[model samples]
Target: MTRPTPAPKPSAPTGTSAAHVPLRWVGPLRISGNVAVTETEVPLATYESPLWPSVNRGAQISRTVDAGIRTTLVDERMTRSVLVEADTAETAYAAARAVHDRLDELRAITRATSRFAELLAVRHEITGPLLFLRFEFSTGDASGHNMATLAADALLGHLLAQVPGIRYGSISANYCTDKKATAINGILGRGKNVTAEILIPEAVVAARLHTTAARIARLNVHKNLVGTLLAGGIRSANAHYANMLLAFYLATGQDAANIVEGSQGITLAEDRDGDLYFSCTLPNLIVGTVGNGKGLDFVQENLTALGCREDRPVGDNARRLAVLAAATVLCGELSLLAAQTNPGELMKAHTRLERLTGARDAR
Candidate 1:
């Protein structure tokens, strides 16, 4: 029998300040708590599936694009090796050129346009002995992990050929997984599943807010929801919303499967002023805006509604959705906290407002 190593203790948040506001709401819900959200998009082309050759390859390519987009984001900073997508091969090439022109750096490009249109984009940075490469590309549709890997591998091969002396190293490909693992490890005894911690100073204000302002340490609400579903349990909590969004992603040519691990890790805390903060960090979000199922009329319409353009990179849209999901989860956590602490307060307030409106309308 192997004994598990104890989880490392979590370090207190550095640079936390005392609240100056008498009745301030902090964390994800509070206006005082500073939260940062950023997103990126890449485009991909449809390609042949390895599993089935007879079926249209567009679906496979689309999936790859989604995975590639997720890979680029989820980290604190963007690196080289970006991805791009477009409707035609010409457009894909043009997009790559445009990105290169903007950055004014030499980059290697690879085309996977047999079944669809696509391009692989990457940027390089050197930090002393480490050569950091940030890549963004379009995966077309479905879960484009394979396509992204192919593109990145091809580009890296080309880069290696050009720069003979650059020693490339292997880093974690998925940002959400790596970050969530680190976060979870900090809270739980290395591998404890259900762990809890309090975010001091930030926890105070999070306690008072009606919105999703609580800071969470190691709760992946999405994963929990999926686990419940797999175990034949009813859907509850913000996990339901995550499921809906994931369905949309899958049906609309994004990577639906990643929803399982993508929805992991969250931050909830309170401040000195009884305010609450809540934030969700998903490091495994795989999404795309073009290729595969995107060609479907309804999917295209949804993309339009979401303000995604064919000329733009799909990763950009993925980032937007990720941020929206995080915000939504934050709000949901706040609702839970409010209801748990002050039952029926929101309902009574709603009834009071409805009565006041009715009286005014009668006049």
Candidate 2:
């Protein structure tokens, strides 16, 4: 009541102050994948205290298996969409055709923009006098947001100069569907599309997860598949991919907002002879080895620790990072789903862990 101390007179800004979040290294998880084959611990920065132990439990299970968490890189690309207005619908259609036919020329423009950004494909949508061109590129090492944008800018400039009867509408037209949840990103692919799989023995599932394989499989069907369908989820079917993705993204110096689309994934489970076959497929795992936000001291340390700072091929580091990120998701998703299979298990764990840490409103 004696006046709040005037909020300490509002300290002066020092350019930018760091927002320090709780960081922990979870898991010496064994991940054997197309991109990575190593047992590594991942750094996760999140406010959720329970996630550390939850992922750690899944990591423990991974150690018991021979193959461990097997990750596969399905596809990888970053897209940038540019909108242009034509004089008429026919002109827009013609311009779209011209762009598609001139892929080589566009590639040259993209190459001129950035050495790492290579033009992969150009797809277009025409609506009346509007033309939306989605340019896809393979951006090496970096997440490719800036690289794609720079290439798109150059391509757009060339199109305006050469293509007739079209003017710039906007650099982005949502057709690229960067962060927003959309069906196209899942179907066509964006970022690093990866799938992580693990086959747990019957005894391991019973002893570690404390649930039968049949129960976890049934839960995946009812909760992940059907439940997501009922919830009108655009292109995602998972219990809590966002939680792990957010933590991993923060720790690895990724564009955390990319988790919006990055979390759009599928969790598949099957009961095979009392064993469990669990997999998490993330189609939009947007991460990078070298890019913005990675220059920070802590980020550099984390990346180096994760073996992403190696002098491998141009795109290997980023792909390796993506694989690890997917494996991390599998660990967290598997643990959370196992917890949810039993009534009150999730809440009890949350309450106990949060209360132990003195977090407000433990429940």
Q: Model 1, 1-363: lDDT tens per residue?
A: 999999995532321111111111112211111212222221112111111111112122112222211111233211123222234444444444444464323323445322321443444433344444555444432235545546556555555454434434553333213223233222221111111122323333333333233322223333344454476542122333343334334434555554454444433344324333233344434555554556755456545644554454434554444343333333434343344344575466546656764576479
Q: What lDDT is reached at residue 61 by model 2?
A: 95
The lDDT leader among the candidates is 2
TM-score of each: 0.38, 0.94
TM-score for candidate 1: 0.38
- Estimate, for each residue in 230-347, the C-alpha lDDT of model 2 and write its tens digit: 9999889999999999999988889899989999999999999999999999999899989899987778888999999999989999999999999999999999999999999999
Q: Runs in model 2 with CA error above 4 Å? A: 1-18, 359-363
After best superposition, candidate 1 residue 30: deviation in angstroms? Answer: 14
